[model samples]
Target: MSYTIKPWQDLTIQDDYMFKLVMRRKPICKRMLEKILHVPIRDIRYSDDEKTMKFQYEGKGIRLDVYVADDKGTVYDIEMQVRKPSDDGLYLRTRYYQSMIDMGLLEEGADYDELNPSYIIFICPFEPFDKGRHIYTFRNVCLEDTSLELRDGATKIFLSSVGTADDVTPDVKRFLEYVNGILSNDAFVQEIDQEIKRVKKLEEERVRYMTYAMKMQEERKEGIKEGREAMQHEMQHDLALKMLKDHKPIHEIVRYTELTENQIRKIAAENSNVSFGEESGRNV
Candidate 1:
């Protein structure tokens, strides 16, 4: 909550907010996707680009950085992951996002075959899988027979900017290097840099970023408050347990812990090993 907010002027393409803004640009988003996918994209249209998609009866929703669908109905969710997550966490996140995308695309009574092909892409400034490859793409396939492909139409791609292998094209490598804080004259990178500069100068975007920072700070403060309260409650419960173990009177234990008689009774019931040393009928 006490951390400094990064000035809009200091933001780069790697920043989450900056990345989302740049990806919102149709040309940049399309080209970036093409560069990562190594395929030509005729055109792309936004689909729940900024809006968080919520599923029926689901409380939590997913906010995708860039969600778009190409002319062929193939969908894409592109995210810039600056922090390295646990391997399992990252994999589960992609799985959840994939499921959410599917839920958002298919309507009630729609045929299963109507589902469009989709890709969940995460761009990381650090090596994610430690494979030393610029890109790692995943698709479902039969485990026993490696040659057998599932053709599930769902793909998850992780791009590591720190990759050492010469597995990606020069343009892609240049972009990745820029993400890794190495400046380059690549046309796309230059355009993205210009866009970041433009966004920084816009008063409206600056205000938006400020609002976002404030909200994040408030959330952090609230989380800290809740944690402290929970810790205090747990401490009280622990103290009450110790007192009970010491054969302290129920009323005395309640007075120390500030716990209700019924609550203390429940605790005692749960921990039957604590023997009572005093009468149960003590005055409040």
Candidate 2:
């Protein structure tokens, strides 16, 4: 896959890396949650410095853009999604993330009832559900009785930048508009814009971005090199197979295809229909 690194100065809050940096400001993050959830957040703390969690037992992991917990034991995992998810992909991802959050909170042999309430929030520039709503909040509910709630303590919220409905607070509206590249006079928006400029001016941040881009480029080059080698290897085996089918001796196939005797024999072994033989007094 090809990756083009955007310049640091060109980054906005919508950028995942920038968003994570901005959310590191606890005041801004807490205010954001309060505005979006329409609740008061006394205080919040980072679950980890990097907000990355790994499910080592399953060999799977997630790198969250922002992960925090409030004084009330409520956990929030915020993500900045630039691309639109296909069908229920995002919803399913929320399910997996919620499970990971629960797994992280519980100790070995811990009671399930001790699980904290968690929220998986995705802020996107594009509408996820095509519902034209500024925000979509989901929770488990009984299908047979719509009024019956499962109260699973797990919630998923999707905020859309292009939403048409007036379903969010003024602060959230300003935030969403800012995400859409529309500058607002709102204090929160101005603060975020200033933070973007401030971060871009940091020498260490510039170096970090540069290093990341260079690393990605190196990995891409390595992948291309490996791909080419793999193609050449497969081509050699194909040529060896064709030569063997043409009644060529093992040594002749080896000299032409640059394949060893063992490799040619292995290919012949797989293709039971192909006749295996040595000819022309060649010893392989």
Candidate 3:
């Protein structure tokens, strides 16, 4: 809904479609990765599902923002997260993403060693950690010996745009600024900006993006509404059970718990201990 309310011309570099379109250019993606990882990306290939990808398990779906693999067999999931997920839970989501990507990389009988190295990168406008740093890189290490590495060939990186620390390079800072909508003179960022303009000019692409945005918004709001309704139902069920234990009158229980007469009777019948007490009272 917000995307619809926002002007089409006001779309930022961090907008999901814009992010994908700009990064689809190999040169731009390679440069961006070089800046983020501080290593040269000689050549990189966008995944076949570069624009849109779905990872679903157990009837739940997650759409990957941008996915790619470099010439050296290193895989990257670069996501521009405009909204901070609940309670900075993005880290846990990254863990889930790493597993999902790993599941897709190997064939039926592929060796474990054949699994390509992965980097799960999240570019956020705000600090993911409360700590003041532009970049946070995570890898599994031994708790007893900090020097010991798990060597699992996986890394998760979170980069914030508003960090005040002196840790990021000028180009990195400029790129982050550009993502935040501050115009940049940096060459790599300039190329990205040009691509953004080109993408905005595509009438068909813009229409597709608008449609996808509305569909996702509806799904998200529906999920939230369903979650609230389920929670209320659970609360009512708990209260009904407690009223049954307390030997409350069936009609009173139905009135307070908003349950049907038959449902209240069923709950009261389920608690046979309460029935025994009622029978003893009737005998007395």
lDDT of each: 0.86, 0.86, 0.79
Q: Write the per-residue lDDT of candidate 3 for residues 46-140, one digit (tens) a residue.
A: 77654333455444556677788888989899998888888747878998788777777764354678888999999999878878788899999
Collision pairs in model 2: none
Clash pairs, model 3 backbone = none
Q: Per-residue lDDT tens digits of candidate 1, residues 126-235?
A: 87887899999999989999899998799999998999999999999999998987879899999988888888889999999999878878877887998899899899
| Candidate 1 Cα lDDT to native | 0.86
Q: Estimate the Cα RMSD of every predicted model relative to the unseen true structure.
A: 4.0, 5.2, 4.2
- Give the local distance difference test score of model 3: 0.79
The window of 10 residues in a row where model 2 has the poorest summed lDDT is: 275-284
TM-score of each: 0.80, 0.76, 0.80
Instruction: Tell me how far the alpha carbon of residue 110 in candidate 3 is from the true structure, in angstroms, after superposition.
Output: 4.4
